[model samples]
Target: LWSSIIKSKNKTYYLGYFWDKETAAQVVRIKRLELHGEFANHG
Candidate 1:
């Protein structure tokens, strides 16, 4: 299993777990965009 996490503005968000790495990364990316807005890092 793969898990994704995002830390923003001193907060840590748990984005759940997935069976694929890509899915995990995608979840983090979406969450980052939502949380960080224009400052989101897609790299």
Candidate 2:
């Protein structure tokens, strides 16, 4: 399993665990957009 993690400011957000790396990465991207807005890095 792979863990998806995102850190913003002083808090850490856990996207979840996934069996596939692409899924994990996708989750991170989605969460980042939600949490960081225009500050999120797409790459």
Candidate 3:
């Protein structure tokens, strides 16, 4: 699992902090799927 929390200027941003290869891969896969879905829906 990847997770990160950053606070700056009262704004918080969470960044990837992958713990393992599998987790990183899963994140990438999910992101790709989401992008694909968005493109399919819009195009």
Q: Which candidate is the best by lDDT?
A: 2
Assess every candidate by TM-score: 0.87, 0.86, 0.46
Off by over 4 Å in 3: 1-15, 38-43
RMSD of each: 0.9, 1.0, 7.9
Selected candidate, larger lDDT, 1 vs 2:
2
How would you encode candidate 2's per-residue C-alpha lDDT over 1-43 as one tens digit per residue?
A: 9999988888999878999999999999999899879999977
Best by TM-score: 1
Across 1-43, the per-residue lDDT of candidate 3 in tens digits comes to 5564444447665548787767665655565455455553321
**Residue 23 in candidate 1 has what lDDT?**
97
Runs of candidate 1 exceeding 4 Å displacement: none
Clashes of 3: 0
26: Cα error in model 1, Å = 0.4
Put down candidate 1 lDDT per residue, 6-34, tens digits, no spaces: 89879889989999999999999999889
